[model samples]
Target: MDQGGAPPVFSVTAEGDDDRVHVAVTGEVDMATADTMFQTALREPTRALTLDLRAVTFFDSAAIHAVVRLSQRFPATLTVLPSAQVRRVLEVSGLGEQDWLAGR
Candidate 1:
């Protein structure tokens, strides 16, 4: 839920086995929901993790920090598929060239 009128829709779903897990994030991902998203993504502790953020509509700095923390935790095992919105932020943050980013 955001600070505005209607509560913003936010969800984090993870699938696949411990070998490789995929997490899809949708809706607004701000300070309010970033920690939940981070925890959800770590639930499985897979050898490899792919974050599908193509459906995310809003991504704040907190969200980016969460992603960075995940990347640090997983290191070589982390991969991210960023939406246009997320990608723009990553680029601005100088993280766009990270190897963890998929589809460039």
Candidate 2:
């Protein structure tokens, strides 16, 4: 679902079994939609969560914070399919190459 914000924030549905939630995130994720992302991740009762960010075009600090927060809270295995731009941001933010950010 694309959460309408100051900018268009987009994300995908995460249907879960007992152990995973799958959300394919696209477009941009900024402050306005950061909370929504966290909420969606937390709502899942799963050990594995996949955030496919292959289609994401943009994101900011707030989005980074949300990712970190979810990493800490859920302990869900997170698969981040970041595009080059988003990956650069994550790398700069110190979360890109970490084991925690690696889903497998």
Candidate 3:
């Protein structure tokens, strides 16, 4: 569900079973909303997790940090579908080549 202000600058939704969960994130992901994104994505237990950030508009260092921490939790099971905004940061942060990133 969306958890943000009036216009809802951020929203996160998760679906799938315990074996495979898909989390779709939309809107901006900055310092204020990064932790919420991380926590919401992990609200469900799963052996495999996919984070879809294609709709994110503003991705910052805090968001990248959150993604990294989330990946660490899932490691071999984590997959990230990053948007242009997120990809840019990942590339500059030297994490764009991570195995967890899809559609590289």
Candidate 4:
């Protein structure tokens, strides 16, 4: 939600086999909606977690914070496929250079 009207249209889906969890997200994510992404992405423990953000058009600091927390909680267990927009943000925020998000 953007806090001015109806909640933003955010969709997150996590699906994978026993050894991994694959997550996909579509839509904007700001302060009001970052928790949804975080909670959904970390719903269960797995040997690995992959986050696909190719459909995401916007993400704010809150979204980055959620990713930081998720990584801190799961350590060395996340792979991210970010859209150009997302990559820009992540690069500006310095997370783009993080090893966990590398080579995606």
Clashes of each: 0, 0, 0, 0
Root-mean-square deviation (CA) per prediction: 3.4, 4.6, 3.7, 4.2
Off by over 4 Å in 4: 1-8, 102-104
> What alpha-carbon RMSD in Å does predicted model 3 have with respect to the real structure?
3.7
Residue pairs in steric clash, candidate 2? none
Per-model TM-score versus the true fold: 0.89, 0.79, 0.90, 0.84
Residues 4-103, candidate 1, lDDT per residue (tens digit)? 7654479899999969999999888999999999999889868889999988888999999999999988889899999999999899999999999987
> Poorest 10 consecutive residues of model 4 by lDDT?
1-10
Q: Per-residue alpha-carbon lDDT of model 2 for 17-95, expressed as tens digits?
A: 8887887677778887777877877676888777767777888999898887777766646666677878889988777
Q: Can you give the lDDT of residue 62 in candidate 1?
A: 97
Please give, for residues 13-45, the per-residue lDDT of candidate 4 as tens digits: 899876789888988878988999999887877
Model 4: pairs clashing at backbone N, Cα or C within 3 Å: none
Q: Between candidates 1 and 2, which one is better according to TM-score?
A: 1
Q: How close is candidate 1 to the true structure, as a TM-score?
A: 0.89
Candidate 1, overall lDDT?
Answer: 0.90
lDDT of 2: 0.74
- Angstrom error at residue 38, model 4: 0.7
Across 1-104, the per-residue lDDT of candidate 3 in tens digits comes to 65454555788989999798899999999999999989988898889899999999889999999999998999899999999988998999999999999988
